[model samples]
Target: MYSPTPSDWREANRKRWDERVPLHLASDYYDLEAFRSGKDPLRDFELAEVGDVTGRSLLHLQCHIGLDTLSWCRHGASRVVGLDFSEPAVDAARDLAAELGLTADQASFVAADVYDAADAVPDTSYDIVYTGVGALCWLPDIQRWAETVAALVAPGGFLYLAEFHPLADILDDETGSRIEYDYFARDAWIEETPGGYADTTTPTVHNRKVEWQHPVGEVITALASAGLRVDFLHEHDTTLFERFGSLELRDGAYQFPVDRPRIPLMYSLKASRAVA
Candidate 1:
């Protein structure tokens, strides 16, 4: 039986993310140089799903290092704010924004827990609330998360969530075909992962951490209960990372082998708040 206090788990994860900031900044996977040279950090799925943030005020929650948040500004968002629990990540984002010459009015970064975002951020509502890949699994409570998301959305605005499918998490990535873990949300997963997806070779001090899994149904239901109407849910066979051994890189994304069974690796949902 593995059970840890929420504060303990959050601290462990924050330390891990803090260590990852430097590695991710230098890793080819993130391509900091490309981002510095004016390349978009956002993926194609989000670009199509979120559909143009030009002059919109966007909020990115659980934003690690704020690559996607900065990208929103590059796409012409008038206001972009990123919130992450990791201090190092937030600092790096702020430095990068300054280096890129983004004014304070254009972008800002805050160090705060997702659950405490209402206190950390000034605006109670935003035109768009965007949360990207690998963000949800870190949150233990999806219902509370959805409530925060709903509170952040301006009237008539929408929340866009692009996350790795829970099904993908159950698959045995080492074997790449069978399910090894529980598909449904259960107890917290406590483990010692010294390496991260970005750079596995680099050793990390904050190795022990906790993660939670939320099924697709749970995610949708949480949002709906939070007063947001689900507009659309789209699942994709391709993913941003080669999460399984059987997956192959195709056009910058990972796809299952031609002969293998196709499964949903990622999903994006758009939920809207009605005007007051």
Candidate 2:
């Protein structure tokens, strides 16, 4: 695990994420009702392209609250396991699993830091290692993250990821029109003052959060170095969530301000081990 300069930064960020869990569950972004009724928030492209997962042992990394993980089980994954760093989220996931009666011999939840507990998870155990949206932005290093992914996969197994595009990160959050941040990797920790993304008025009373950006090339190269062959790299003009300030929801998709029509909003990649 690559240590941050100030160790307190990580703790503070973790706390902030823990506090945001309930809010996210309540937010429209993660509609619990829809999810409970067998609705899959993931786009059709991902569902269609990922193909049949029935009877597969699937591992979900950074599975906040395990909504998507449970969704995978609902979609016929034989065994589904969710791993996350947040204790509150993990607890909530367990409770939801029990309440929904989704618990089975094949479903379980595990909690640990993504970087530190790599060895804790069994090696060559999972047939499919899946990651969801809004996951990669929390890490500090893409190479280390890739190494973690490589360590988790079984021989001949596949790794799948759907994340916000690097180009989307370049837009100005306030105006949402001009490009502000760089496309390549940049290391600058952002500290939001108090309030959370869902409720900006109530101060979170914490201001330390860290995030890292990895470009499309950097991500592809890192995965390839980890011995995962790229099967598909897709850039979509739509997003699964509201990212920019000026974006509008149309026909179940989020789009730009009409001026920047060429930019990609999200990306999904499917990679498999050489043995696969």
Candidate 3:
């Protein structure tokens, strides 16, 4: 199992993510050039589910490089703010926004630890709080993260998240062959062979990345505990990114196999605060 409980684990993860921001931007996965040409990287599922944001105040958490944040402004959001712990990423995002002629007020970027994002940005000021794929695993504790989300969202506002389900995290994918990890949260960390999904040549400095698993039930319960009511929870059998190592991309989305027991690959949840 992974070491470091919620406390120090989060700090370490934040630092690691900060270091990875630059690498990710240059990687093919992000495709910054395509994003700059006004191309939207968001999937149709999210685009449809999130609906319109015209004139709404939106806050994007862990908005690595602000691609989606800019997309929000392009879609008619009056104000959009992006928060990330990575300084390099935030700088690039700010520069990119300016390069695109987006006014400073229309979109802004902040670099801060995720847990402290609410303190760095406006409190109770956002109409929508948005988070996306591969976000939750980096977080060690969902409860504290929920509190930060609740703090930033205004009354009647909602928090929207589309993330890879925790269940997918457990399986083994050594040969892109079979399911491996436990379905339930058991170990704090699982020691894996060296290699990241993006880069397989270089050995990771900290080969082990600590993670926590939160079942759909635990996720809903945690969010509700933070004073946000669960509006809907939808689980899909497909994912946006390549997961389980050998998954193939088809029809603009990644898929496993239909023959195997359909495991929940992704989930989206909307929660709202009680009007005061």
Candidate 4:
């Protein structure tokens, strides 16, 4: 298939995210002050699935604003480094780390594309390589992304990813019931919506952004192909965002109405590089 993403995706997507930095920082959605007061942006399942991080070095790929990265530090990760393509995002992350009284050795942020993570991070490898939610869609090639991330994983260490289920891409956005798009379609998805998800009413420029869907199977295959041992792939019925109009927010999670048949709205996976 002909690809238009290679020539233009980075600049467009980075511009979109960079512009949203201030919006996200000020918006009630992120609530920076509350975060400073000790808010956990991470999902409960994520905390349990990844297990203890005490004294372990962690590299958070595509860590926007460092809320989750800093959270790992609170969870006892000895060192945490966050990387993002947008300089604005990385700056915000660095500020957050400092505000939390964390030094560079404890928590650091780098401005770099996720594809260059192996070469750009502070260390050659980490005990844990983490990818947070809603980040995978921004990348065009799951395979290349897998290889890049896999190389950053230290021997006996693992990579944990929590992402929106790609199956949701095929469903209608309003109801999330009717099949509306092809799941296997290989093409760049361009969106020109003028606002960020954090504050939809807040108007913004640099609206053009590109995204792509990678099926759960494709992601697993990519990681395994990159020499990681797949430990577990867990699908969750709840999500943090109101992805569908019909979703109901209950106990910090959004779920389909009780009458509606439940489907996986998010998924998490653990893939580990074998200890030599």
- Local distance difference test values of all predictions, in order: 0.90, 0.79, 0.79, 0.92
Residue-level lDDT tens digits of model 2 in 1-276: 123345565687788888888787787767888888777866788788788999888889999898888888878898888888889998888887886786556677887887754665544468889999888888777888888888777888888999998887877886567878676646554656675556655556556677777788988999999888999999999986577767788889888766765578889999898674
Could you report the Cα RMSD, in angstroms, for every candidate shown? 1.3, 2.8, 2.5, 1.5
Mark the regions of model 2 whose C-alpha exceeds 4 Å error after superposition.
Answer: 1-5, 122-124, 197-202, 257-260
TM values, all candidates:
0.97, 0.90, 0.89, 0.98
Misplaced by over 4 Å in model 1 are 1-7
* Ordering by TM-score: 4, 1, 2, 3
lDDT of 3 by residue, 194-224 (tens): 4455455654565545677777787788889
Candidate 2: Cα lDDT at 115 = 75
Top lDDT model: 4
Q: Give the higher-TM-score candidate: 1 or 4.
A: 4
Superposed Cα deviation of residue 74, candidate 1 (Å): 0.8
Question: Clashing residue pairs in candidate 4, if any?
Answer: none
Give Cα distance to truth, residue 85, candidate 4, Å: 0.4
